[model samples]
Target: MSFRKRSEVVNTRGPGLQNARGPTQDSIQNARGIPANTRGMPVNARSPVPARGPQLNTSRGRNVPSLNNNNPSFRGRLSQRMSNMNINDDSNSHLNNHPGIRPSPATSQLTTSTGCNDLDSLLGHMGLPLGNSLLIEEIGTTDFNSVLCKLFASQGIIHNRLKNGNSQQESNTHVIVLSLNKMWGKELPGTYKGSKKDIKKQNIANEQSKISVSNLNEQSSTPSRYKDLKIAWRYGLKDEIGQKNSKSTNQDSTEYKDYNHQFDITSRLIPTPTSDEITYIPTNIPVSSILTQLTNAIDKNPTKLIRIIIPSLMHPSMYSPNYFKLTEIIPLLHGIKSIIKQNESRCVLLASCFTNLLQSSISSSKLLLNQIQSIFDSIVLLEPFQQEMIQLLEKSYKTQPNKIQHGLIHILKLPAFSEKGEMCVSRSEYAFRNGRKNFEIEEWGIPVEDVEEDENKDNNVDSSASNIGNPNNKPKKSTKVDLEF
Candidate 1:
C-alpha cells in the first residue's frame, strides 16, 4: 500500500505546473537579452527611437517635410538664397516706351532701325538688335558705306525728335560720331517725298475729286446721282470701305513713329539735329582716350539710347597710323564691346572700314581683319561692280535704270542676341542699288541679255531635237568615202 501511494503523488503537478513554468522561463530569457541600460525598465515598456530626416511619401513618391526644422541643410539654404535674388528686374520695361525701339519680328528682342529699311531687312532680324554692333566693310575705295552711316545717324535724330517733342532739355537718343566732321548733321539725308510720277498722280486725283464735288451739287436732283451713291449692300462693300478707312486712319496715326522711314539721298534732313543731340569725338586722340570719351558720353546719357557711329574706322585721315596697329585697334574695339555689353539694353554701335586699306593677302593683315570682324555682332561686305560689270548692267537695264544694281552685298555674320543665338553666314545672292528715293536690296538674277541668250540656246536644242525624225533636215552624206571593211 505504501508503494502505490508514492506513485500517485507525482501526477498532481503535470499540466498546471508546466503552463506556469513556461511563462517564467520566457520572462527570465527576455530579461537576460536586454542591455544593462534598460535593466530596470518595466517588462512591457519600449526604448525611445530617434526621429527620422526627410522622407518620400510611399503612395505619392513626393518629398515629405523633415522632422527637424531648426537647422536647414546646405541645399535648403542655397534654394532660399536663389529665390531671393531677382536679376532681370525691370530691365526691358523701360525699352518698351522708347519710340526708336521695337520688338524684333523673328526674336522679339528690342531692335532699332538702321535708317535704311532694306539694310534692316538684310540683317535678318528686320532691324538691328539693341546691344549689337554692325561692321560694314567695303572692298574698294568708294565711300558707299558712308551713305548707310548717314541714314543711321538721321534715324537716330528723327527718333530723338519724336521722343522729346520739341523739348531740347530732354534727349531720348544720343548720336556720337567718331569723326572730325563738324557739319555731319547737315549731311544726314532727308525723308523721301513722293516721286514725280506719284506726285503728279496725286495732284490729278485731287483736282478730279474737287471737280466731282462741284458737279455733285448740280447733279444732286438727278436719278444718276442716286444711282452713283447706291450702296453695294449685297457684297458687304460698305463694311469693307469702313474697315479700310479705319485702317488708313490707324496707319496715319502710327506712321509718324515708324521704325524705318524712306529717305531721299539727294536732299538734306530738315531741321538738323542740335549740338546737344549729337556729339563729335576727335579721332586724333589716343585709343584709350577715345574709349574714355565714349564711356563718358554713355554715362552722361544714361537714360537715352546711345548710337555710336564710328565712320571710316582706322581711315588714314581719321585715325593715326599708330592707331591701325592690332594692339591699338583691338583694345578700342574691346572697350566698345564692353560698353555695349554693360549697357546692353540701351546702346548700339555701327562702324565702317575699307578692306583695301588693310592688305588682306598678308597673314597679319588677315588676322587683323578677322579680329575686327569677330568683335562685331554683324558684318556686311560690299563689293561694288567693276567698270565692265557696271557697263554690262547699264546695257542690260537701259530701259529700266532703277533695276540695275550698283554692288553686291555679302552677309558675313548676322546678329545673334536672341536666346537661341542663331546665326547665318552664307553666300546670299543679294544685290543693292542706291536709288534716289531709297536704298534698295533685292534678289539678284542674271542679266536679261544672258537670259535671252539662254533662251536662244534652248530653242536651238529644240530645233535640233525636231530634226531627229525629219527627212529634209537629215545630215548630209560624207564627202570622203569610208575605208572598205
Candidate 2:
C-alpha cells in the first residue's frame, strides 16, 4: 500500500518550475533567450500524453505518510474485497496436486499401457489387479516369456484404466517378466518400444499400445514397484465403461481349449499371448529355476492362480538339485495339488509325461496317482499305445537297438519313450548338436509309422506261445477257467 518517494518528486524546489504551470508562453516570451516557443510548448505537453485525473488509492497520490499507507487504520476498511483468490501462475500447484502421473488403483504403482488384448486375457487385468500373483505355466510352447510380459503389463493396464481417467486412454502397457526358459523370437510383437507404441494407437492419447511391460535383463530390487490386482482392476475400470475396447484378442484360444480339456491348462490362461515384451532364457533351463519361480509366486500370494508346463524330453538328471528323483519331484507336485484344492485361485499343469514320464516317473506306484490327477485342471496323456508301454521299451532296448533307434532317431526322429507318443529330444543328449536348449520341433511330430514296425512286438511275442508265461505277463482267463481236472 505504501510507495517510496523518488528524490526528484520529494525534494525538487526549483523556483519557476513549482507546479503553477512551469513557464507558460507569456512568461517564455519575457525570458530573453526562450528559444522562440520551440514550435510553441514543452514537447511532452503538446504530444499525446495523458492528462492527470482521479488519483489511484495509493501513497503516490498524496506523497504523505499515514497509517493507511502501509496498514489500514482501525476505522478505515478495504472498499472492495480482493477480486479473486488466484496466483499469476498455476503449473507448480497443478503438479503438486497430482503427485503421481500414472497412479495405480492399488498401492499407487506407476505403469504404461499395452495396446493388445491377446496378451491380457491370460494375465489378469492390466496394471496387475493385486490380490494374487499369477504363477504362469506355459503349455505346448516356449512363449512363456511373452506370457509373462503380458502378465506384468497387466499391471500397467489396470493402473491406467482404473485411475487415469477413461476418456484419455492408455497407449501401451509394459510388462517386466523373469524367464528361466528361452522364448521364441516371434512371440514378442515386432514393434516393441516405449512411446513409439503410443503413436500406433488411434485417437486415444493415453493408449500406450496395450501393455509393453518392460523386460528387465537383470532382476531389480525385491519390492517391485507395481500394483496388485484389486487396485489394478479399480484403475482399469475407471474409463472403460465408455472407452474403445482393444482390437487384439486371444488368437490361440482353440489350442488351449483342448489344453483346458486335455492338458490341465488354466481356463483363464487359455489362448496364450501371441504378442508382448519379454526376456528369453536360452539354455537347458534347470528345473530348479521353474520350481523357484512357483515358490516365489507362492511366497507372494498363496491364493493366486498357478500354472506349470514341462517338456517330455527332460531327463531325470535335468532335475538335478533334487537328483531327478521322481520321488522328490512327485512330492512337490503333490503339494501343489493339495494347495490348489484348498484355494479360490486355480492351478493348471501340463507335460509330455502324459506320454513319456507319467506312469514311469510321475506315478511309479499308486502313491501320487490321485494327487497328480487332482492337481492339474486336466491331463492330456497321449500314449500312442493304450496298453502298458514299459514292456515294449524293455524289448526295444534289447532285441533291436536298431528298432529303438529306427523308431526314434530315424523313422520317428523324436527321441522320447517307448509309448511312441511324445516325440521330444531327450535331455541326456546334451553332447549332441545344439543340445537341450530352446525347444526343437524335430522332436515332436513324425510321419505316420508303417503299421508293421509300429506294432508292439512285445505284445505280439506275449500273445504267442513264446510269451504266454513270461514273468512280466500273467495267466490267461481261459487257463484259469479250463482247470477242470
Candidate 3:
C-alpha cells in the first residue's frame, strides 16, 4: 500500500548554463548563435529518455539495480511471500462450501460404493472407482439386471444426503438417469438393512467356534492325577491366556467391521426437500444436447461427485437394434468416454444393455460389444443359466430349501486399473434371491456334479427313455373302466 516518491534531480548550475554542459536558453539568447532549424528541439524525437518513476534507474538502455542499494532484496521478499501461498487450496475451500458440493477425490481415496456391497467387493476397490465407467451386460429379456441400476442410483441418493460429524448436511451428489423408458423414478430401490436371520446365523457361528475352542482347551488341560498340581496350574494358566487372546480378537472384529448395504426394491429412496439428487433425461433429446445438459449439470456442482446411470442403453425395445451398429453407438460412447476422462474426479458413468439384444445377430453383436466394452473401465455380464447349468445347480443345492436364482457373473472386465492375476479372479457364481426385504448376493460353490458329467448324461438318457415309454415293445391292452354319473 505504500508508494515511494521519485528521486528529484536538483538543478544546481547557474541560470545561463544547462547542467554544466548544454547551453541554456539565456546563454543562447545572449550569444544569438543558435540557428532557427535546431534551436528549440533535439535532432531525434524517438530517442530514449531517463524514467521519471521510483523504479530502478540506469544510465544504459535497461534499468539495473545498483548493488549498493538494498531495495532489490525487499522486492524479492515480497515475491517470495506471494509464491508461498497456494491458490488451489483457497479455490478448493471456496468450492467445498457450496451446498451439495464435495471436494475432488484426487487426494483422498478414489472409490465409491457400486451400491451392492457384494458387487462392490467383486469389482475390487471394495467400491466403484471414481471417474470410471462400468458397463453391465444382462443376458436375455429378463430385466433383473436393471435392479443393479436401481441400486446404483439409490445408493448415490443415500450418499448425497449423508451429514458430517458436525451435523451439517454437505452438498448432495447428483444422479442423472438417461433412458428411453419412462418408469425410472417410480420404483427406485429402497435402502437395504441386512436381514435379521443372516445376522443371527453369523452370531451363532461365532458362538459355536468359541465353544469348540473352550472344549479343546478343557480336554487338553484335564489332569490324570491330583499329584500333578503344578502341571495343572500351568495348564490352567495357558487356557486363561488363550481365552483372553480369542476374546480380544472377537471384540476387535465386532467393533471395526464394515458391512455392505442391501436395498429393497419394494419402495423408493426419496430425496430430501432441499436437494433433488435424481434427474431423469429422456433419450428423445439429441445426444449432443444430452451431453450439453450433462456438462451444465456437472458445472452446477463441480466440487461434488456425480453418478450417471444409462439404463437399458441401446435396448431394442427402446431403440432399434441397428442403433447398436458401430457407425452409431461408437461415436456416442466415444463422446461419453471423453467426458468421463475429462471430469474423472467428479463423475462416474454406468450403462446397462440387454446382452440378448446384442446376441440376436451373433457376429455383429460380438464385434459391437467388444468395441463398446473397450470404452468402459469395467464390464460385467450377467448370463442366465443354460439348461445343463441349471440342472447341475438344482442337483447341487437340492438339500437347501431356499431357491437360488442361478446366473453366471461373467466378469468381462474387472474394476478399473486392477492388476490382479487371472489366478486370483473369482469364478463364484452370482446366486441371488428376491425376498420381502431386498435382493441378496452370495458366493455360490461350483457344482460338485461337474466332475460327474458322464454320470449325469446317462441318468438323463434313462429318464428320457422312461418318460417316452418303450418304442420297440408292442402296445399294451387298454383297460376299459366305466364311470357311473
Candidate 2 has a TM-score of: 0.24
**Candidate 2, 329-393: lDDT as tens digits:** 56555554454344322333333332233335543434444444434432222112212343454
Candidate number achieving the greatest lDDT relative to the actual structure = 1
Q: Ten consecutive residues with minimal summed lDDT in candidate 2?
A: 431-440
Best by TM-score: 1
Ranking by TM-score: 1, 3, 2
Native-referenced Cα lDDT, model 3: 0.66
Regions of candidate 1 where Cα sits further than 4 Å from its true position: 1-94, 163-170, 196-257, 360-363, 417-423, 450-485
> 126-169 in candidate 1: lDDT tens per residue?
78999999999998868899999999999988787763445453
TM-scores of the models, in the order given: 0.66, 0.24, 0.58
lDDT of 3 by residue, 90-174 (tens): 3345334423232223324356666776677667565666678889888776776788888787777766666765898675577
Clashing pairs in 3: 100-171, 100-172, 101-171, 192-262
